[model samples]
Target: MSFQKLILRLAWSVLIGGSLLAGSTQAQQLPAARDTSFTVRSAYLKEKKNRPSISIAQPALPPTVQASYNLTYCTLGARNLQLDIFYPKAKRKKGYPAVLFIHGGGWRSGDRSNHLPMAQQLAAKGYVTVTAEYRLSTEALYPAAVYDLKAAIRWLRANAKHYPIDTTKIAVWGFSAGGHLAALVGTTNGDKQLEGSDCNTSHSSSLQAIVDVDGTLAFLHPESSDYQVSERPTASKYWFGASQTEKPELWQQAAGLNHVTSQTPPIVFINSSIDRMHAGREDMIQKLDAYHIYHETHTFPDTPHTFPLFNPWFEPTLNYTADFLDKVFKAKRWAAKLGLSLLGDSEDYTCKS
Candidate 1:
């Protein structure tokens, strides 16, 4: 067995005991490096061993933007969390804004790679984009993923020189399950668990803007009663660490809606009417209004949750996100408003080819 695999096995045995924690809760074993006639050696090492490292030089002359893949950073457990970075490649350039993306799979089964196409699309538009990977459900739960996300933000700020990231202007975009995570990260300002270790040297997980794509926002709402899963209680249980009825307080604590405040980041929360899972988006937006936080809510006709990425609403949604970012980052007086008026008349956001 490889030494790292041995150590990992021992460590996990101690943490997980005999049985798996729950659904999709299996840890991926590191491959053993050496094997005998009856033993199996590493199956994946050939690719890593053969690939040559191409070091991308920081462009001496300023370019409007640049993109790179597979930038890695450490998470709370020292797991090598990887992210893809997109930014302006030129020196003397205005530190372009940064956007971190989290994917959706009920907090259990998504990857940073799923956001690759989206990251590349954004990177092409002069914004620094990072598609990040956080530990999944089978291995960890609840706050573990949040911790990794916060660590990613901190790592980006600390290593601003490594990429052309704007520390002062940061945004988070998440889809479905990821939308809930993005909202939670943006809403939770001083959460100690989400804070990075002493090595981190940047501001907190407070984002300048939040883009929620078909995610649940409230823990106590009747909306989530629709997701009936047998193996797991509900999607909320997988995400917030408790069944809503079993532990209301814990659910509320993790619910992004519960964390809203005047200081909450400007948010663009979107969902499709055909997706029953997001029945709560309107209610959540109402709550955002109560808190006097600036936000925009959109619903696409006949489209299901998260389908905006490829369906008819895809281009419109992307354009809305880009426009929303510009308004939130540049507008000062309107930042204090919580009404739909902050969107500057609904006609401005009307879908157009």
Candidate 2:
């Protein structure tokens, strides 16, 4: 094994013995060369001999995740919003369930590449994952990012046949700023006002599931300002164009919690127990309850705001995510066939589509 691989393996072995890490998690083992993977290995990769892979399922290792980057999904004015698509090369009888990932940089700044590892990990688990770029505070403000996301979803659905994604099985996943957008997209289904007339306008922007990691749900709430930052243009200020005091209505509109209704999709919240990082979450949970929406929350106790971006925490974070998606997707299939609502309410989302 390569020296790096040896160190990682040993480190994992010790970590596993501590029972703090998921024992089933394994990375690709570098071959003294390469085999089993159908694609040609680069000289550098082939020399490693063993590539490390990890799996939460029965597979010995992660499936080969193929990444296609910088595919333009939509263009608003001069800005060309793009996405990086990641999926396993393993063919299936039908299309794979897909998830659109949004990155977190307080919404002021963040590139989609930050979530490439996440896209690959999700793709390895038999899902088509797309990490997309939307307008930032540097480019536009408020709903522009949300509109871009909705456009991307529409674009994905319009090209679903070519990409082989199950149009009926789409979800949105995001972290922090992306989390808020994902939640907004999930809750605002059928709202034409937010669904900008971008590419693939005919396709629906509705989502079947949402994964929010430490995202804000409402700017109107007092708890929303829990995080104090020194960035010249704070995320909220830049995104909203002014303080909530100056434009309360616009701030409320930008917040996802203000839009949650019975039509919202099933949502799973992965967060740090720090509470404020997921400001307005409990309030939204209460709203979801009142609306009879299906939702779940997984809080990582005593962790930093960057829990989802790093290891130890990342494994369990993803494990919960994969498991939640699997459960929701399976139930969604049955809910559609039965013509029943997955949220245990009268709203038949599957049938609506």
Candidate 3:
């Protein structure tokens, strides 16, 4: 039972058995309900000796804080959806701005530990970072994963005092399928009632901004007139339900771009040129422009999807993310050197309000 195999199994199960929409209603879009018990577990994953171990030589002191453990916040079936939070432990009066990260495995397979290195690095650079696991595409469909992550945000807000997080300064960052969820969370802020059952506080789970890396924003491609369907039959069948022609409106509802509003938060979309999701990225940027939303787009000249995470530009990309978040938190127009360490790269970035 290696880690990869375990995650694959979980993914398979979720996509196969759990992704039944609320009901096969005749409506254009299936009405979604709050899924409170969205629990994820590491027991679904085993230690992989061959793969890279999630070990980072974090400095052992303040201003470089680190915390690693599973927090049982949401539950699904017998397993509790666990989240890993990492932050720079500072002696300052208030905690740092929190960044919630979601990993990408095509809404199917991925683990919280997969993003541990990024979490640790961000934490070391003085940001409260969290990587969480939500029910995958197998167990639930489009809105389920979306709802679970929103629940995680609500859980963080509810336990802000316990974690000493600054609720007002929260941003979401995700890749691939996780990127889709992140973008949805950013744009769909008006729909807050889906906070699920774990809410007992007034803190809102709405994100201040979003960072989407190679996620599908536009399900309906502009370049393709044929509407060549997705290869993942289960993904298409479960998300859109039946034929695209039979339910064009439902299919549109599943598309993230259709939901974008002027109220959408500031966004930073990054992607690789060769990725299949590139067209969707461009479409999202165009839509953002049409809505007058503040956004930044970065394309990794000649790389593939998720390459920015564990390879050559790892430090650079993470640094850019930290810097990007810094800008978003300063959206209120600050008047100080809200500078970033830039992963120790000798880059000087000092801005004022």
CA RMSD per model (angstroms): 11.1, 14.8, 9.5
lDDT of every model, 2 decimals? 0.63, 0.71, 0.63
- TM-score of every candidate: 0.72, 0.75, 0.73
Question: Per-residue lDDT of 9-111 in model 3, one digit per residue for the tens?
Answer: 5665554444553322222133233332221223112212222432222223344675868887676545467788877666446667788889876565666
After superposing candidate 3, which stretches have Cα over 4 Å from the reference? Answer: 1-18, 21-63, 192-202, 223-226, 230-234, 238-243, 331-353
TM-score of 3: 0.73
Across 236-313, the per-residue lDDT of candidate 2 in tens digits comes to 765665555656777778778888877777789999866767789988889877766667889977665656665556
Query: Candidate 3 lDDT (Cα, whole model)?
Result: 0.63
Order the candidate numbers by lDDT, best to worst: 2, 1, 3
What is candidate 1's lDDT per residue for 216-303, written digit by digit as tens? 7865666765334223344455455444565666666767877776567678977766444554677767776676566777877655
Better of 1 and 2 by lDDT: 2
| Per-candidate clashes, comma-separated | 3, 18, 12
Worst 10 residues of 2 by lDDT: 27-36
Model 3 collision count: 12
Top model number, TM-score? 2
